[model samples]
Target chain A: MTTRTPFDIPAHASSDDPRVTLDEALGTFEPIPPYPPRTEREAEFYTLRDGEMFVNMGPQHPSTHGVLRIVLKIDGENVVDLDPVLGYLHRGVEKLCENADYHQAICYTDPLEYISSLFCEWSPVIAFEKLLDVQVPRRAEYIRVLSGELNRIASHALFMGWFALDLGGLTPILWSFIERDEIVEMLAALTGQRMLFNYFRIGGVNGDLNHEFMSRLGTWMSKATHQIDSNNALLNENEIFVRRARGLGVIDTATALNMCMTGPNLRATGVPFDVRRAHPYSIYPELDFDIPSRTEGDCLARYLLRMDEIKQSLRIIDQCLHEMPDGPVMAKMPRLIRPRPGRAYAAVEGPRGQYSTYAISDGTDQPYRMRIHDPSFVHLQAVGLLTPGNLIADTMAIMASLDPVMGGVDK
Target chain B: MDRALRRRLEARFGEELTGPVRQRHDETEIRIAPGDLPEVMLALHDEPDLRFRLLSDLAGVDTGTTMQTVYHLWSDSSADWLRVIADGLSRDDPRVPSVTFLWKGAEWMEREAYDMFGITFEGNRDLRRIYMPPDYTSFPLRKDFFLPDDASRSPGGGVRPMEQTHGPTNAETAAHVRQASSS
Candidate 1:
């Protein structure tokens, strides 16, 4: 064994060649031969047929959205099989939450899905509240619904851009970003951050809606639907975009349910099984909104389903604003919360489907075990099932349509 | 809580359950022995009146004494989220049946549970580490993993475990060196 000190400057520290150690670490990246297969699964995945070959795509590729690497076994251009290699971004968020106090634990989950951090924060906050059995004030619940809907619109806006960009269109991303930026700025005015907004607190939100947020929301709500529709017209009817996406990666409803797929991806397959409508939680039963669904179950269907859902979110936000309640935002709770020894499971309808948290408290300040079930992790697993019969080019299209953020996948 | 759903679960599997069916808030849970996992899961999936088609979440928990594999199921037949816990598995050799035959997507969640808590799913074909390095020996999420202690004795630390074992300096000195580095 070799010995080293923490402060030691290695032999290559001053060397201009950065690629020297990296080259040694990369070591061909071949499936099997130098490194023997450790499990039956590895052996099966690595055993390529005579006409088939493996193509390694992005732990760094642009279309991957985050640092997700997928190894594809291809026969010419058609993909025979694909295996997703995760953990490039794993930070052990569950373990971290176990170590942290209940209130502080919300910070760890904030970055799990960077694009939809509000939903990420909402699940755990609600779970912790359930464990403590605190009833949040009605106004706070309304604020959560309002801001969460705004965040969902922002998340879907980014999704529209990324989906079109993956299909080789550049202008749609620019248009979508402008729309996304407006909502993001409004959220920043409401909460204090743009990206990983740790705004959701246990039993309520961090603060009530401010004047700037309301003014911005009022301005944006008037023309938001028209802007999104005008931006979508660039690719919604285009022959190339529609043809490329329409029939690609079609997953039937039964298969989707069997795979435990949730959110818009499953809705695209014609089952309107949304957590909000099915299992009503946190002011959703009071809100008047429809769970938009599509029957095609293709990449195009998934893309269009999200577009329909965004209009529904705007409607929900409008209703929340009109029916704003008069009460304090926060519930009565201890500063150092010690929930009773029990378990609680809370799920919210996120932009990516059911973002849920299962917490087991040992009647202590810290959770005994906090199990976070990210939909991206579950949705990404079905990629191997969906991409087998399609071409290698269509793999990225299917993945983009499914929209698995790597942060959530690797958490 | 849905009292009818709880009654349906109790009537269906009263003999198989290890404990009373627990209902709290919007959740209902049942605990069963590890041996009864496959049959119970099959009945939950196949029976028309109790068709819990959607497997919402699967997680493994190490409660310092024994291991548990928990399954959260969502179905239209029930109004509450049904949580089925396969409890009382020996921590040294925790083994449970794979639910992949029912929900193929559970293959990954089972892999993740195995990766974190070292619980083995007997019939899972792809039972490899989902998050950790392939050669990693210790499970990170196990109760006895002791992360902070292991982090102090990491390879790059000035006071190596080897030095504490054989060198003239005592274990306290090694701990001191770790603190010095952390500072």
Candidate 2:
């Protein structure tokens, strides 16, 4: 209920203390030289004549998305060397979770990846349930898949808007939100929250979908198809959009996997490694859907993959609607949840990427420590690897395709 | 963990297996001495059978006794997930060899571990704080760190103090509100 942000602990009591410098604050962690190859690709395409011109692209800029600041060394328009400076939006979500108990901690994960907050909300709940060995009923499992896929469609719609916004197309984003808002509204009806729906409980959901929600969802599906069509019409085949994003910011399979890029970003690089299919959590294994991927691994492929994924999410939603069982949504929970002294890891294919949570319980009501393995934190690593050779203009396009939510990246 | 990979790791690090490779809630954890962390991780990455090329996550835990570093690894080929735990370091100097050389994805994660738990990842190229500012003196995630208000954070407690620390006490507020309504 409070408006205060976490990670608000001041680094310095006052700025006057010259002795308390940023370098002096480092306990033992040190930054070493010979950083990853500044520009590893062909020099003729994106190299600069000189590497002296360094520019900070973010910490506030819109194109970088969120508060990410990339220190770009330029030669004319060519980027020579780059270093992504993060932590601007750090809210200490991981540190805050340990102090709260099992049920209380689920809400804290909402803002961590707010694009499809239902997905982010599910990771910790899944982890806690796994640790405690709680089994959700069959009906609740179907509800989870129902909410998750709807959230994915909503998230991808927003991505379509923002990605086009990055590429200088305004109308597409406005149109994308028309469909996204309806899906989000449908979710809000189920969860009682408009934006950060902390709806997923340890064993089940906060409540079941009402009759009105199902009726509205049935109507919204037809409208959502038109919204997806508008985005493709605006940006997919357009001459300028394709020319700009076709070959820009291409990453190979080895580098993408090595960087631990998950979700659509990893899938675009031609690796069919979806956590839903590969790991098979919740009701995902029961449902049938394809993990659409592209071999090109460029900005266009990344953008197109998300668009295709929206359709796949719709397919999942269609199945959930047709075969959703009628039963209790809330599972029976113990008065005090005390999972044994062990650790549990659970992941959901979040809108941003593979959002996973590792919860360690020391046989107490409270978790000893909880770590969020956010995909954006790992996916952001590709920024430094992807940016050095491309033009400064293409930077926004590359960053847009990555689709990082600051909550997860800085959590 | 797959049966074959567990045997290979146990065979490779004969006595250094701190304990039996224990299964914690379906996931297997391979505990290694702090000294043998880098070696075990290298073999996990390079050895043909277990290619845990993807470093999913790296985190630090304050176990009341010592600071423990946990590494979660994933194999793309087999979809096998493994947890490699490096234990045995006091709070004063939690030094463990950095695995930045093995997985490039570990750079920021290790930096974050160092940032939160003050665990020193020796030889990590960029060990700057990933979440907190570089100048932050306290390790916020450590078990001992607590805000003054954190003591009173328990739910459904009786006779709770008012949140306004610098204002009138609750009794004073009640009196003031009564006076205003009467006036």
Candidate 3:
């Protein structure tokens, strides 16, 4: 048998290059004999040989948390090849956005990234604001920060809960949901919905936070802090949790940077890149909080970083509640938003990572085009790199650690 | 690496730069010709101060007459965001060069653009249906694509609500209650 090396293509190649043909380039690397035809006597033509095992993980598995099917080729206990098949829960959200009005489209954004619904809403809302040249009021900015932080805490809690669930612990999922429910209730009071809160408008928020909501939030924040501390002591101190997660999905700083992984996943690799601190949108410049980072780029490090981020989010929320100025929740925007013929992009440090929106307004009330930059979408790319050369069991651990809400992925 | 670098880019890529490279209302937008997209993107990615190595998003916009593609690139090292706009192509022939080779993150974004706007990328592989079904007809995002209207549907073709009787007998009411309870 003759083996060939992987083909190396230049970064920039001219259109006239003879090696542009995909078949010719790939053919040079390997030559495998064609498969024999299936016979009537044979039950199946594609049966696995003695050592090879082919397993279909799920379009309905618990670890994925959504309809994501992964076809794994295993050699003994180690995974040799993993091909991710998508489109199981495809709802054609982008196509639906095209038909929906700019304001009405906010309803779909929340569902796009169900885990971090607020950030999804923020992306489109902020983009619309930029396209229309509308400045949000100070009170609205404070309210936006408060809501965004609450959503962040909620998302991280779900991640922590789900990560523990993947590692075979049932208690943390229940414990995490308690904090998540409180935050969701606080958000529901302002937005009038629980899961997909379409509360952010182009110019500012949809409405103001009431006194009762603020008081309840203050109480929930203190209770959540105590619960998180106690929960951490219970879970973080467990020897099994530590052993499975400590260095299972170790990604170095260079690979993390190259892969474009963001949010807590990237921060866990020791690169203190928080878009809130870096870009500083929506009164984030004034808010004081630490950008959490960990030297170990592993599953445990990401878990620790997310926990720290939740604390930091609490600090930001407390500050916003204290310093929130009394004013109109929304700015004076035109009845019909007909922006000049130009394109603009707005990004925020979402619960997942850097959620961005690129909108093109061509002198019309409706956006000419809209593109959402989901952090989970980019972070999911690192999964293939991390999972290879690891055992099948460890693969689930790494995927859970990444915390990719597949709605964001398949959107 | 600062103001000087912007000036150098402006001078070297003259009309290719399109408009003045400046922030408008706290957001930065840089326009370039379709052909100049790869060069401008490379320069933005390579420049020390403007190390926008990550192509955060790539989306297409239709202006009724033409289609425009926007690229949002961000640098993790610098925490800087740069919005690059390429001139629109005709709706009939929406073709653009792919940037997957430079940044692998553009793989899904470009596929999304293709799926929604019917804009074809020259070098992208595995460009089959993304969010929509493989057999779905017509681009749903286009302004002209209309949703199915019940008013326009032929008589008896549209879904109609089940007719209800004003008064119900004891047996009929009991049957309804039983059905509801079972459901």
List TM-scores for all candidates, in order. 0.91, 0.85, 0.81
Considering just the first chain, candidate 2 attains a TM-score of 0.87
Residue pairs in clash, model 2: A112-A408
lDDT by residue for model 2 over B66-178, one digit each (tens)? 66898887775444568888976766778899887777778888878877777888877767666765445667676555544555544433233332221111112121110
Per-residue lDDT, model 1, residue A311, is 90
Model 3, range A85-122, lDDT digits (tens) per residue?
Answer: 56777776665664466877778777998767888888
lDDT of 2 at A201: 89
User: Which segments of model 1 are wrong by more than 4 Å?
Assistant: A1-28, B149-183
Candidate maximizing TM-score: 1
Ranking by TM-score: 1, 2, 3
Candidate 2 local lDDT, A314-357, one digit each (tens): 89988988888888887799868988777788777877777788
C-alpha lDDT (0 to 100) for residue A131 of candidate 3: 68
DockQ of predicted model 1? 0.37
Q: What ordering of candidates by lDDT runs from best to worst?
A: 1, 2, 3
What residue runs in model 2 are displaced by over 4 Å at the alpha carbon? A1-51, B1-8, B76-80, B152-183
What is the RMSD of candidate 1?
A: 6.8
What is the per-residue lDDT of model 3 for residues B57-95, given as tens digits with 9 covering 90 to 100? Answer: 777765555556788766645434666777656667677
